[model samples]
Target chain A: MDEKTRRQALKAATLGAAAALASPVAAQMGGSKAQPGGKQDPRSKYPKPPFKSQSQPWPGLASKMNPRPDHGDTSYVGSGRLTGRKALITGGDSGMGRAAAIAFAREGADVAINYLPEEEPDAREVVELIRQAGRKAVALPGDIRTAAFCKDLVAKALAGLGGLDILVCNAARQQSIPSILDVTDEEFDRTMKTNIYAPFWIIRAAVPHLDPGSAIIGTASEQAYNPDGDLYAYAQTKAATMNYVKSLAKQLGPKGIRVNGVAPGPIWTPLQVSGGASQGKLVTFGATAPLGRPGQPAELAGIYVRLAEDDGSYTTGNIYGAGGGQGQP
Target chain B: MRLPLRVLTAGGAALALVAPAFAQGPGSQRTREFVSASAQSDQFEIDEAVTALAQSENPDVRGFATRMIEDHRKTSQALADAVSRSKLAAPPPGIGGDQSMFLSALQSARGSEFDRLYARQQVLAHHAALVTVEVYAASGDDPNLRAVAADTSALIQSHSAMADQLAAKMEEGQARP
Candidate 1:
């Protein structure tokens, strides 16, 4: 058998054995299970790519995806890790931001989410989910490309949530181009502004309001380390994201505020279907990972939860990765 | 039940507010303890708010009491359903000892005094309740109970913020002509 098939069979055998044996070791493997002894293997947990060649406008909607990206809508069971915390998340309508938003609300936090106005349909779904979780949800729809709006976004979030303790700068712009020659200055500037500049502005405005125990999380990517030629501009911004996370963590460490980053690899998000990946690449997306599948946004929910949780007081200047056995490149 | 002992301050007679304690550390709360505490907390809020709805002339205090009743009832029912599903025995009947004492203190007051006391008690009660749910949600033994705790935490938080604002407004009114 080929490596992928063999691995799948091995995983299936292990799962079956665990079910039959009901061993303590098997029980221990049930990470994040709603109940004990309810283990599900990670490899087969979510949708794999061989995705349809789909496209959306500049920003995409999670609701419209063929295999809707899971944002822990039902699967994530939060323990009151973030009770009474207030959060501000960019791109909270979809992807990692959406997953974090859902998780935060479930963990007992009031959340303010920002997205493009076009993403209202998706943002509305998130708002409803947050409210259903019984937390306050503030929806702020606007472009992050402008420094003015980014500053306003934090101010609005503070006003809406009544305070701020968690800030997740997860919104990003990625458009894969075959060559640098085809990359326009406007596209580069857009990527830089959305990925780098916006965080700079948002964090600047938010830091003054953040108390000692507050946390700031940035969504970096695997492309930061192993630069994809097509994602030249995007990759560099991710690297910048990682760099800033480290730099700021030190700067903020003494004040007791934590700064961290999540570097996701080959996760199935709206970013992919919306010009973030070429059609050919989209079909085989995440196939290169050792797991032979793309990841769902839900998989990274715990990492974000941990980074923001009070228990992670000692964990700062860190970049937690969920790259599906691909490691840090 | 013993009322929170009222003491005369240098400026005026003030109700020495006795803050309710959850009696459990963070992440170590048991399922039974969680259910019992949650049910009691909800009952305390609902019962006190019911009293406030009748006694308070201030619209803000009355409105807040109305919301507390509506929201706490939902959380109370949700906790009961979760307990039923788990086949855990029902939590002890009625509110806790401390809650009963505070309720008595609230009952003895009159007019604007009652409104101020109600607002203050709600803030303290919700703060304590927030901790109880948070501790259980973080490290409770039962998954379903934890989920309930987590979900309820947000509402408790919102209520806490509202109570703070209401208390501040009341203070402002008292200070002004």
Candidate 2:
């Protein structure tokens, strides 16, 4: 339908869902009842905010998240794409990594998740989800920015899964500097090391054992293109990541390995709540994208699945832009 | 490629429609169908890729394919209701011809051969997808479809940039003794 009609239809559907949830009869029939301000209770079918601000730097695990970051668990379906494969994903405690991990497990791939030590609780929950999906899950706690840690991580994956088929260099750190002049050297270095250099280190360490047909997918960003003034350093790092993926793709192509990247626009993930931006700023996300709303994690899961499976066999050394049209180019 | 004249003319007309903010009437079902059909076509490409990756034996290809499937599926579903309302036919399958041959080669091969074939295809696919999204966005009648097309076009551009970088890197790697 046209934009206007589509919008109207979406609005109508949303209202219908809300109304269905609000009716007492519907509630009696197992539907959730709406609370004040059109909000659902925290325990309701629709997530309710436990606190006024659900955006914290460390929102912790999905289970513990107050209102919870929407990861689209109910909507995602696995088609056995990664059956019998094994993967290692950094920052798998929550957000995009966690969503990817869940989808991977559902697809029959065993997973090894690495998270910061402080994020143990969140890591545990993701591990449980993997196990529940009947897939093996190894939770490794360490800092990925260190080369030593990266090496150890590879060793652990080898020991845990016997072999690794996929390496998702997806962890990242972001802090808004408002302007180039305001960017501190420490901040710039930290962002670069976390978002760019860390991936480089991990890939280097993992390369030795990666067999032909193994894949490496990096999590870049929409900021790599249409960067905002405030995210100069973060954007620069993400842009560098895309180049890194490109270079890696070519260097590894000879070895029968494929390298790629995913540049997500404004998807509501833990990164948005805790990475460094204020909650107020994040609430306006997706407004600027053509879709006019922030994307949920569930929305991103399918793309991750597509890239990690053979469906994209003819795809490599490429970047898939999942942004809501914010950085189309 | 230069912008199509049709887009430029359509853009002018759209601009006229936008001036008064509410002057123009809502789009017709046919217009909506056209836009929806265009979006469905993009989704179908993604779905096809997902289906292929799910059954792939190569881990690298499989991993990348998995992500594409997950992301594109969500986007496809997000547009489903709208596309359904329009009742338009989906875009023709696979962009066809030599591109199909190249894709098949990558899927069936392994090792260095696979990589080379895949890299070449990445460039071609992104370029083609970019053109498709751009033209549809600029000239399509449905505002939402145009918006989605424009958004996807930007993404394809990023892919193109990434492809260029990959091509150069592959060239450099090949040059090494």
Instruction: Point to the candidate with the largest DockQ.
Output: 2
lDDT by residue (A12-46, candidate 1, tens digit) is 43233324434343233223233223667666666
- For candidate 2, chain B by itself scores a TM value of 0.58
Each model's DockQ score: 0.01, 0.01
| Candidate 2 C-alpha lDDT tens digits along A245-295 | 899888998998889888887666666556454332343334334443455
Error of 2 at B107 (Å): 44
Docking class of 2: incorrect
Q: What stretches of model 2 exceed 4 Å from their correct place?
A: A1-55, A58-66, B1-177
Q: Residue B170, candidate 2: how far off, in angstroms? A: 53
Give the TM-score between model 1's chain B and the true chain B.
0.82
